[model samples]
Target: MLVLPKESRKLFKGPFGILHRDISTVLPELAGRTVYTVGDVVTHTLQKNGITPSIAVVDGQTMRSPCSRMPEFSGECIRVENPAGTITDDLVKALTYAINHTPVTIVVNGEEDLAVIPLVIAAPEAAVVLYGQPHKGIVLRTIDAGAKAAAQELLGLFVRVGA
Candidate 1:
């Protein structure tokens, strides 16, 4: 749905939502909430900490390197091809399905970094979405009017190139 333009790369360098240095702190806030995770490390960390998010989006890579420990979820695994700087239609379909069907893991063939944008836009209100913040930590974004607007703004910054 959104494609990153070369000139706008700098805008996405940091986290789009609340940055939590410790994922544990965010875990307590996540109790009894629908959570969707994006990025391998973030998902693995959550699982290791005893929190199984409703959905996880992973690309088998972290920081552009092959992930040593790919997050494993025993649920419906949907695979889609989303290029490094773009969100594919197939991927959006998977995420849409995941919303109704909780406990889904989306395995991206290319990259899952940018998937957070569309996921946030499509996520139901009050849902929580988590993703890594590069060298910092995890970001906790709640799906609400403000968050959705922020995500939509970020996506808008990307050049819309597809029909």
Candidate 2:
């Protein structure tokens, strides 16, 4: 497990890829690529646009508030518990499993915000990982060797918790 330090949290503010106000604008780029959504709003927007992600992670909340309704996904739903500021081993394992099985929805019991780190690190090359950028828009990161290395570097910044 890893916990993000308060001082280092700002490093995660920037987007990992291109930003789009609407998911429709990004749909054309996602064709023939594995898509992983790290937030509920991003997953909902993609689903509303008729694009089912290869793996969708949602915590049933948006911006720390309870979502009006859960996003609907047509694939198998795997539930995992990840707190607000920390990533657990369960999350890493679930993400790995989801990467192996396409069209899986990871229903997080806590927050899903930081799941993008593992998603980017473990996703196959050329896979697209999408997440909401708060009030801005959706950030789309296409997985590559550079992206994987960058995500791994960021993960290294997180303080390991427990044994």
Candidate 3:
């Protein structure tokens, strides 16, 4: 387990790719690339646009509140337990498994916000990881050596707990 510090918010400010107010605007860029959605809103937006992500990670909540029933996704469903403000070994394993399986939905028990870190780290080169920026818009991060390195560096700041 790893606890993220409040100060680490600065590291997450700049996205690895573009931030689009309209998710549809980035559809062309997602073509021919594996898409990994790290939030409920981002996944729902993509589905509404008729685009299914290769992997969707959701905790059935938005802004710490219950979401409108989980959306129906077409793929294998794997559930894992992850607490708020922290990442667990289970999440890392689930992300690794989901990336390998492809087209799977990871239903997290607690929160899925920080899942983007591991998603960026485990995603294949050229893959796109999408997540919502609260009331702002959607952030599209392209998985590359630089992005992976940055994610790893940020994750290193977390305080690791028991395995």
Candidate 4:
């Protein structure tokens, strides 16, 4: 089970927690002490509310799109390596999978500036948000709009963990 604090969403890589049903052992702390996703929590919540969410994996897509390609920067003008395509088929595959699975919320951690678009279009009701870094682990950028508050909370949690 994964119990991720709402604030820690950014630092998390995949689902709040990836549990092996057979082994039944939790991994060591990945980041701060907080547990973002826990099966027990999810189970209780589901028993109380009757909800199950699928997991959506968010990957990156180049800014350029079909029929256009980002050139290998050797000189002044940027060139298109492949005019046939801009976005990769794998990205489409992942997105399509997400649509089919229909998880409760799609957590996006892609590098694109505005990843919320496709995710929103694909899963309109899903919670599309980004993650931030842990203060002690990385300096983290101020411009990361999604992770700011989470980072601050992570920092506080870190101090608590240290104490």
Q: Which ranking of candidates, highest TM-score first?
A: 2, 1, 3, 4
The collision pairs in model 2 are: none
User: lDDT per residue, candidate 4, 1-163, as tens digits?
Assistant: 1123446445534321122332122222222221111122222222233333242222222322221221111112111121111222333344446556543222223232222222333432313222211121111121233343443443333211111
Q: Which has the higher lDDT value, candidate number 1 or candidate number 3?
A: 1
Cα lDDT, all candidates:
0.89, 0.89, 0.87, 0.27
Q: How many clashes (backbone N, Cα, C below 3 Å) per candidate?
A: 0, 0, 0, 15
Q: Which ten contiguous residues of candidate 3 have the minimum total lDDT? A: 9-18
Off by over 4 Å in 4: 1-53, 56-87, 102-115, 133-163
C-alpha RMSD by candidate, in order: 1.3, 1.1, 1.6, 18.1
Q: TM-scores of all models? A: 0.94, 0.95, 0.93, 0.24
TM-score of candidate 3 versus the correct structure, residues matched by position: 0.93
lDDT of 2 by residue, 40-155 (tens): 88888888888888899999899999987567965888999999888989999999998888789999999999999998988999889999998888899999999999999999
Off by over 4 Å in 1: none
lDDT of predicted model 4: 0.27
Residue pairs with backbone overlap in model 3: none
Worst lDDT run of 10 residues, candidate 1, spans 154-163
Question: What is the number of residue pairs that collide in model 1?
Answer: 0
lDDT of 3 by residue, 29-131 (tens): 8888888998887888889888899999998998888887455675899999999888899999999999989889999999998899988999999999998
